[model samples]
Target: MAKHSKKSTNLWSTPAAQVLRATDDTRVEEIDFSLTPGFDGTKADAQELLAERGQVLSALQEKLYANGRSGDLRSILLVLQGMDTAGKGGMVRHVIGLVDPQGVDLASFGVPTKEEREHHYLWRIRNELPGGGKIGVFDRSHYEDVLVVAVHDLVPRQVWEPRFDEINAFEKELVDEGTLVVKVALFVSPEEQRTRLQERLDRPDKYWKYNPGDVTERGFLPQYRLAYQRILDRTNTDYAPWHVIPADRKWYSRLAVTELLIDALERLDLDWPAADFDVEVEKQRLANS
Candidate 1:
């Protein structure tokens, strides 16, 4: 599903990733998770337009980490599914802490280890991907191995039902090997996940981000909304697509995931990597130091 070309500068007006795209007529009971579709600003105008797009998303993530240190194989993973107080660690501390945490690679998949359940649940998600031109993020991924192993049967519907075509052929071989995945779910309702788990039990500094198993996983919220509407109906893939975001307005889901990561680093039309050695002989040897 590789046809993504839409970046003639847009901060919404139908760009919150194609208004939260998860098609095949996505109807997770008609999502209104606190509706803010295509945004009409205000949470102080989306925090002053996410602080004016954080200097164009930190100079397009430092020109995609300097074109991946000049080797440039391209990258961008970003998965982040949801539930339990669904703000995926406040979208990783406000939209991946606005980049350049050394080109970002986050990864946060909890509860597997024992050599990750003895391998092959994408072997610890292919050892936390993100390499060339980084920006990986997961936070709760591998679609939580088919939504918490098919909502708590933990594994057995003929082994998580052929893992939805082995996660769409391992995300179409990670977009035929140049990465660029970007999944996202974060719907969040159940009255805003019960007022964000009661404001994380009435905030004693959010009491270490409270988790009494997120109040026993909120009594299986209708089996996790029928296992996230069958994982947005069998892995909504158009070369790795799935955007659902409402997320009960945590500042419009961190300004729609910071405009879906600045429309995926402005559709990778990245430049600024020239200079293989002699830029006028290193400016005449640093102008005679």
Candidate 2:
């Protein structure tokens, strides 16, 4: 019998990091354990994975619609964060497209307005939280406190450092208040990202999506990675754990996101509220009429 090293055993047997990678698109080929009926992106079954994901989303949308009719008031907040060309928008389009538009809201946060900048960092975010019985999606969220602000030195180091705790506490409060918080950080490799960016530049219609500033941002990929690692390390709590989705393959990214969302909504145990009746009064009114 041959003896195996502990590290090798852990890597091969565990779901730990096999589905995700620190700096490569290879892991996009692996099955995401976080999703049921795990389908690896590189395989031919990728289309099947997406189909299953569609079913789950459809079911979730039905439940949400019924809950809304009964005034059950369930709120879900989905936060998506990633570097440029990481498929944030694409994930949103594919995964949430089937959901009832009335029951869902999508907010994309960009550079703050002058008025928005006047208040505290979270003011803009707080104003956007979902009301009862609705799903709110944030394309890029308050994590900017850690990502963009840190990258550009927009704030003092101490100010941004403490925001990790602030964010965790804030999310905990939302969870405690009957809101389901789902945070997804899409991870894509630099090489894959370069390809996507070049595609955008080459296509006339997609030229709007390309920014000269993105070229500048590409230079600071390492710093952004460090910031993201720290963000994940600090903010990944049970109340709002971050799902690091492998986003090199847009199809796989959408499928994984849809599965995770379905799982979260299922855990809510939502039900349609029972109706109240005033039978005697209704009968009397009917007879009079």
Local distance difference test, each candidate: 0.83, 0.74
- Per-residue lDDT for 13-67 in model 2, tens only? 3232223222322222243423422342343455554565576566676677677
Q: After superposing candidate 2, which stretches have Cα over 4 Å from the reference?
A: 1-38, 41-44, 278-289
lDDT of 1 by residue, 1-289 (tens): 1222233134356778788888898888778889888776568877877767766777788888999999998888888888877888888888788777999988899989898898889888889999989988988978788888888988888988888899899889988988888888887778778887788789899889887988898888888888888988888988888888878889888888877887887887788798889889889999998
Give the lDDT of residue 120 in candidate 1: 86
- The TM-score that candidate 1 achieves is 0.36
Task: Report how far off residue 241 is in candidate 2 (Å).
Answer: 0.5
